[model samples]
Target chain A: MHKFANPTFFMKIANGIFPWATGISILCFAVGLPLALIISPPDYQQGDTVRIMYVHVPAAWMGLMVYGVMAASSAVFLIWRHTIAHLVARASAPIGAVFTALCLVTGMLWGEPMWGTWWVWDARLTSMLILFFLYLGYIALGDSFEDQERGDKAAALLALVGSVNLPIVHFSVEWWNTLHQPAIFGLKGFSVNAAMLQPLLLMVAAFQFYYIAVLVIRLRAELLSAKIRTARFNLAAAE
Target chain B: MTRKRRRLYFVGLGLLGLFSATALMLTAVEDNIVFFFSPTELKARTVAPEQRMRVGGLVEEGSVNKSGGTVRFTVTDTVESLTIQYNGILPDLFREGQGIVAEGRMGRDGVFLANDVLAKHDETYMPPEVADALKKSGNWHPEGATAQAAEAKPATTSN
Candidate 1:
């Protein structure tokens, strides 16, 4: 772990992973999207609106997964003082936030015809909303302090706090007598048919690859920026 | 291993503490996001009558019918119509020719049975999907009395 902690060594590994991850993401998206958007049959009940699920479900999954990643990275950063982990957590915020926003918008679109309103005070929806806000908070706190280290620590703290919301978001639909639909994917017997399930799982795989791709690129950029900062500081000391 | 590492360890512990607390708070409040829908989209896309939805549109003028506890009306974006049925008493803003949103399931009989209704009491409002559907239908007229008077009402409103 300590050997890999060297930023130069990390960058060597990251460079190799970046292209492979990007290629995989593109390939997954190309295959998964059509299967989701066209090849997959509409819901026996929802009709065409079920297409929104392809976008909405994966985004919801990304949102939760990214937060989980952020919290885990935050733990590593705080405990190990790993700069790469901090960069990874920082890099992930905006992408995760975007996915959460997409989830909310697509959800609103899906709910209108089926639920009768554009918005609802349901368990699932509310927890997701909070997740969105948490992402926003992480971004804000990460940049809030004058000392960059302080800012990073603050954001790490925020990410850890926000991680707890994820399980609640997943289970809220079940615990409360809300209008939101119950979980389609669970450890108990699966509710979704094989046709819809296959594409959904594919999309999930695609999104995971996409997140990894983005994180590597962003982390590299962050490392480069830090290097530039150090170079400038040394030049000033020499002068 | 070193003092700096020890310092980082404490910071990690602090983050874990903060994370657990916020997670609890968010879980406690996890019941507040609402969904919105327009009347026309509900008509075109909703295949199952029993599937739940949130239906939004202007309550057509003179279309609201009340018989005892039940109220029946046609929600319109002027291009498409969806019938709504609500059994409970409605809010004061639930008026004919006003923008309202209803949440419930579509009955197999092409009627929307609302469990809850929300009215946009203010004037500066139209459900966002109304504009989207109208754009698709090539009927871009803004809804309200002035616009209704300007263009010929569509085929369904006369019913």
Candidate 2:
């Protein structure tokens, strides 16, 4: 576990996987975009507007999944005092926020045409909006303290606390009277037709790879900043 | 105790307090949840005028009326019904005898004045409550439940 936390070792692993992550993600988008927009038949009810599902569903999944990653990494940082874990949580915040924003925006576009409104304060949407705010709050809190160590710890704690919103966002439709429909992929079977399912799953995979590629890049940058800080300290000591 | 252990305890307590506060807030707001009501459920309770709520079920046969830009329709579970008035273009999927959900509040005159109406994203999809209510009303015939048949049913009923 300590070996995995070492910056040099972690960067080696990140560099190795970076190329594959970017390559597969680009391939996925290349295929997924066309299939989602053209090949797949429009919903019998929704027509062309249903095409938005490809981007919206994947973004929503990433918004929740990235938060989960941040939360887990944050817990590891808090428990084990691993700087890498905290760095990871910090790096993921903005990406998660972007995905959450995409989910909201696409949802609005779809809602206006199909649900007949651009927004509603319903369970699913309200929880998702809150999730977006939580990401923003975490980002801001990470830089609020003067002490860098204290700021990192506080941000890790915030990430852990904010994780409670994830389950609420997911189950809001089931637990409350919500405007959103239940998930398409259920325990029983895929609720959506195969034609739509293919592109949706591909887009989800694409986003997952996108996260991995971006995270490694950011993690490398974080490590470089840490080295620079140490070098600055050394120069001051020499002075 | 070590400083690290003390810090851990503080964080543990903070999380506990935060979670409890969230739980309490959720409980306090429970009544305002406004679950989707079938027309039957809507009938059983009195919703105050301008209180936002959702009513979902099948659009009643031969009930949708268009005049200029305004549209009025009755939504039903076959047992009870609510009149909805709207001044907007309905979703492409909106048709009589098809499952839909409308979000709005009661007008002072008792009619539901809806600003939004939602139809299922797919023909195969039916809001569970709408299906249950239709079944309860003994009017659920799966063979004729296609969107095309739904479009035809209202016209035939009008004739």
Error of 1 at B80 (Å): 37
TM-score of chain A of each: 0.95, 0.98
Computed on alpha carbons, the lDDT of every model, listed in order, comes to 0.73, 0.80
Supply fnat for every model shown.
Answer: 0.10, 0.23
How good is the docking of model 1, as DockQ?
0.07
lDDT of 1 by residue, A1-239 (tens): 68787778987897888888888888888988898888876653356677788788899989998999898888888777888888888999999999999999998887677545678666677889999999999999988899988999889878876777887788765565445656666544334444566677888888988898888888878888988999999999999
Docking class of 2: incorrect
Q: What does candidate 1 score on TM?
A: 0.66
User: What does candidate 2's lDDT look like per residue over B41-66, in tens digits?
Assistant: 88788877768888887788899999
Candidate 2: misplaced stretches above 4 Å? B1-21, B49-52, B67-70, B77-79, B107-110, B115-159
Query: How high is each candidate's TM-score?
Result: 0.66, 0.83
Clashing pairs in 2: none
lDDT of 1 at B106: 79
